[model samples]
Target: MSTVATAFADSSIMLRRNVKHTLRNPTTMFNAVLFPIVIMLMFVKVFGGAFSVGEHYIDYATPGLLVMAVSYGLGATATAVNDDMTKGIINRFKTMDVSRGAMLTGHVVVTTVRCLVACAAIVGVAFAMGFDPEASALDWLGVLGLFVLLAVGASWLTVAMGLAAKTTESAGLATVPLIMLPFLSSAFVPADTMGAGVKQFAEYQPFTPIIETLRGLLAGHVSQGDAIAAVAWCVGFAVLGYVWALSTFKKRA
Candidate 1:
């Protein structure tokens, strides 16, 4: 096989192995898919009336949860990578004829796929709870596109953190800030409602544009400006994370 073909084959093998591990030890997988749904339900049931979005709280809220669900890849990837590094799995792979970059790519690919599944589950549960979005086919496609971008970007960043961490605990902690970003952004509320300082910070944060874009798309009102900003953020995250992850992995491996 050619170099590209061989690398693809190697990455596929690694991806299958990682997926099997995820199936056997499904705690992380369960959390990745279920945690956001529970949070969404809690918000919809308890705080739905209190929220300023009023009648459309479920419609407005589910997108944020979907974005949050997309972030599961980060924590999962970080833990998996850290475990492999500390548990001598990386060493074992190094001794073999595996493609060096293939292992990292496999983790990234699997995380993206997992995020897709989580996003789908979130949507299904949202429907059951009366969270109906009048989005067109194109709008749905745009939402899917943003999700893929987010999953891949987060996956790379977490992979970098995992490679950098000395232990699995620290690796898991690396995701705290990431998981917290949604709340600080315009996910649950409009950034304009925030005070001056906070509004500025919330508006400029990476998660804000993403949340806004997804919310707008789902509501059948695509804000071109926010969409551009969202795509830019995704691209920036993916590029920085990919470079950082590759460099960190090379040094560690």
Candidate 2:
């Protein structure tokens, strides 16, 4: 096999290894999937009425929660990456002449898949809770595209975090900001409803544009500017994270 083909083959093996680990370790599933479902239920059942946003609170909240779900699920990826680094797995791979990039690629791909699955769960729960979207076929496509982009970008960033941490615990802790940033955005409430400083911050923060773009796509009235901003942010994250991850892996792995 050519070098590129060899790399792809090795990466596939690594991906399967990670998937098996995810299956055996239900805690990762709990963190990536179940926890988000519980949070969605709480928001819709417990606090939906108080934070009414023009439409059924579910409609307004689903987009934000979807982003939140993606953000929240990434901690598992970071810790998993850290585990491989700290557990002598990298040393074994080195001895085996495995494509160095394959290991990280496996983590990134698995993380993205986990995020997609978590988002699907959030959407399913939203539907059960009467969350309705007026999105067109094209709008749904846009939403899917955005979801993939966000997942890939965030996965790369988390992989980099995993590579940089000295321990799995710290790797998990490094992702706290990822889990918390959505709360500061227009996820549950409109940025405009926030106080002065917070409102300004929420409006310009990366997550806000992404959430707003999603909200618009779902509502059938998305702004062009917000869509552009959201795409740019995703691309920026993917680039930054890819570079950071590759460099860190080279240095530390």
Candidate 3:
């Protein structure tokens, strides 16, 4: 096999290992899926009345919830990477001649998959709560594509953070920004509704463009500017994460 083919094959092996680990310890999936659902319920039922977005609040909130869902389970990804590094699993893989790239690929791919599944669950619950969208099939494709891009970027970044941290506990702490950024973005309320400093931060932050793009796609009126900004941010993140992860792996592994 060519070198690229070998790397892919090794990544597949690592992917299987991670998948089995997730299955055996199902708490990760449970937390990823359940917490988003609970949050969706709270926003739609308890706090929906407080927002005035001129539409069914569920519809308005669903896109933001989906974006937030992407961030929910990522702490585990950082911790998992940190665990492998600290526990010497990477050494074992090296001794076995496993491609270092494949090891990182395995973690990132599993994380993206996990995020997508959680997003799907959130959408299902959203629909059940009268969260109707105006998206066409093409629009749905855009949403899914954008989501995959965001998840891939976020996963790579988390993997890098995992490799950088000195301990699993610190790794978990490092990922708080991933979980918290959506809240500080245009996810829960309009950016303009926030106070002065916060509003400026929210409008300018990375997640805001991404969330706005998602909201537009779901509403079938996506702004071209937001879409461009969103894609640019995701690509920038993915590149940054991949470089940071590989460099760290070389030093630490």
lDDT of 1 by residue, 182-208 (tens): 888887878888998989999999988
What TM-score should be assigned to candidate 3?
A: 0.98
TM-score-better candidate, 1 vs 3 = 3
Write candidate 3's Cα lDDT for 134-159 as tens digits.
99999999999999999999999999
- lDDT for model 2 comes to 0.91
What lDDT is reached at residue 3 by model 3? 94
**Worst lDDT 10-window in candidate 2:** 47-56
lDDT of each: 0.87, 0.91, 0.91
**Candidate 1 segments whose C-alpha is farther than 4 A from its true place:** none
> Which candidate, 1 or 2, has the higher TM-score?
2
Candidate 1 matches the true fold with a TM-score of 0.96
The TM-scores, one per candidate, come to 0.96, 0.97, 0.98
Model 1 RMSD to the real structure? 1.2
